[model samples]
Target: MSVLRRVGMTLGLPVILLAAWWFASAGSTSFFFPPLSEILDSLVEEWFGPRLAADVWPSLYRLAAGYALAVVVSLALGVLIGTSRTVRALTEPVFEFFRAIPPPVLVPIFILLFGLGDGMKIVVIAFGCMWPILLNTVEGVRAVDEVLSDTGRVYGLRGWSRLRRLVLPSASPQIFAGLRQGLSVAIILMVISELFAAENGLGYAVVQAQRSFAIPETWAGMLMLGLLGFLLSLLFRLVESRQLAWYHGLRRAQRSS
Candidate 1:
């Protein structure tokens, strides 16, 4: 199919489904599933309204802070362990044990330890985001071509110079793949933390709307969360495309060979 046709099909599917939903639920008055139009109206009112902006900012701030910390810490540790066999062996079991545990299970512990404030939420988000990044970084480092390492050594590049010039660039694509995975986890944990115990956030808004039986408002929050996730993933893909342009070019050349 043509690119424009493909794009039209993609956009048309959602529009069709939404139209069907709006029409199907037009006659219903149940709180379980509000009409699509009503939900859209509520979304516009809540998201575009001045008062709701306060709640949105706090949630975004916490998410950004938590995810940023996770990226820095996990990437640093992952690179360190990835480069050192001894360090990787020493930390493997502990990392596996923690990674196996579901993030939601730690919510109560975090709340107890850090209270019901922003600290607990940030920690939870970081905890959820770290594993994917760490594991991916390790894989990325391991996947670096042995020939590249030998070439670097022939040039007398060692230690930090080797890592900075050879290893990191080679590993960047896989590292980015892990980062994309971690971003989704971060968003999930962010909402879950807020849903469980938060005074202000999109998740809190959803809970409040549900409690009040405002079905349209609840749907609006859910839609907003989906949009947020989509936007974040798209942003990551744009960055990945630019950062890994050389990798893509190499792959294209290999395919033609």
Candidate 2:
């Protein structure tokens, strides 16, 4: 399809739904479900200026730091564990135990350890984002075809070179899957972390608005979050498309055959 058509296809449903909401709520007298137009006005007034710096930027910074940290650590540890049956066996129980615990439940402990600052928030976000990526990486590394390993060995690929050229590339599909999952987790954890002991953040803003009975402002904060998540997911898709172009091409070819 053409670019315009594709764009229309993508946006048509949301636009339609938004229009329905706007019309449905046009004459709303309800305090909780205020008119959509009023919410939009509040969204513009609240998020369009100073809050961008004071609230949004800090949240984004924490998300990026935490996500990057998770990705790096998960990939390294995943590769190490995947390469050794002994290590994997030894750590499997511990990994499973930790993974079962909800990340938010540890926020209190994290606050105690790191204080109610950026450090605590970053750790919470990282911890929440780590499991999916680590598990996927381990599985992906372990599932590499033995035929490919033999081929690499015959060509003198060994140790670091083998992992660099063969293992990583082969495992990348799963790695990207984990990264995508981790991104969403990181965003959620960012807000959850900010909800507690926070001076400023999107989540904190929403809480403040609700506490003050500024219903429109609360709705606006939520709208901002949805928009932020949608935009971030789009950006991630663009990156994934570029990174996995070859894999996609191969899949297309296979399917056609």
Candidate 3:
């Protein structure tokens, strides 16, 4: 019953939102805010039909490649810094400095350095995504119970084996949290990069549509972006649940106690 209620709530919320939007935009005067039915019709004809196949794939490809690269590099560096006090001390300040800067501000620099190409987009996404994962991994590693380390040491586990067997598993939940954050940031940067100067991707499509006063098509592109972000977040949550079930169970146990 609880599960069914949860499912209903999830599905019902979006429907209510759409209904509200339909009514609210029924008589909108703003060129940007077309009626919901017109937007939906445009979305179906463009986003779901032809424009989607043409533009969405390029954007999704960039997102996938850039995000995946960020995850791999960030996880490796994060684990290294997390395990090593000296490395953390040496790099943390630099990491914090770069992380503090808003990613959009770097677009011009990236464009200059790498040009308006896949390289530029990938690097921008990776830079934006790295900090969250790195910081979270550090926290996760730092938070591992000392007793577990002691147990591993007592069991003749050392170095890589200890990290793989003890630290990684214990830190998985926090690391996943960071990855989710990083992925979200990556998506934003990916769109921003394309929006400003690119010849491809959904962001470019949106800008083009807006400039041409194709308001309905512009809304359709925006809707596609929202859908993409939603889908990515949902995917991350599913992976997190599957991988961190034990961690969640432990958390529940501790809370109950």
Candidate 4:
């Protein structure tokens, strides 16, 4: 498609929706549903204003820390489980049990153990997000071609060399798929953790605004959240596309045929 057409295709629905919302709520008198323009104005004045750093920075820090920790732990555990039958057999049930549990149900336990601090929230987010990455990696590693494994063994690729040179590359696509899912989960948990107990965060801001009947601020927070989610997803796909460019190319070629 032409650049203009592609842009239109991507933006058409959003534009229509925004226009409809703007027109419909131009003179909104509802306490809960303020005008879109007012919401945008509040978004700019509050989020873009002095309170920005106070609310945003802490949340970002916790999210980054939690996500990074989960990625490392999940990848390590996944590799171990995927490679070792003994470990997999021993731990599969435990992992499944934990993964099956809803994250919110464990919030109280986390809070009691770690208090309403950043550490608890970070751990909660990490716990909530790690399952997808770990499981995906396990499946990916186990699914590697036997022929390729034999070929690598023939070449005497052993230990870390074999894992780095063969296993990780083979499993990267699936690992990344898991990572994408984990990222979405992490975002949700980040917000939820903050909502449950936080001195500051975007989620806390949203909740506080609603409780105080600051309808415009509440809408502003929602807009900020939507924008953040979109931006993060976009950034994630950019990274994934780069890393899996070869996989994407092969798929495209197959489609063309």
Q: Pick the candidate with the highest TM-score.
A: 2
Candidate 2, residues 185-231: lDDT per residue as tens digits? Answer: 99999999999999988888889999999999899999999989989
lDDT of 4 by residue, 1-257 (tens): 59799679767997999999999999999988989999999989999896589887888888899999999999999999999999999999999999999888899999999999999999999999999999999999999899999999999999999999899999999999999999999989989999886899988999999999998999899888877887888889889999889989999999999
lDDT of 1 by residue, 29-140 (tens): 8768777888889888887574267677788888999999999998899899998899999999999999999999999999999999999999999999999999999989
- Candidate 4, superposed: residue stretches over 4 Å from native: 1-8
- The list of candidate 1 runs beyond 4 A from truth reads 1-12
Q: After superposition, how far is residue 43 of candidate 2 from its true place, in Å?
A: 1.1
TM-score versus the correct structure, for each prediction:
0.92, 0.97, 0.94, 0.95
Clashes of each: 0, 0, 0, 0
Candidate 3 lDDT, 1-257, residue by residue in tens: 99899779766887899899999999998877889889889989988887767888888888888888888988889888988899999998998899899888998998899998888988888888888888899899988899998989899998889888999999998899899889889888888888777887888999999999999998888888988888888778788889888988999999999
Reference-based lDDT, residue 205, model 4: 90
Off by over 4 Å in 2: none
Find the candidate with the highest lDDT and give its number: 2
Sort every candidate by lDDT, greatest first.
2, 4, 1, 3
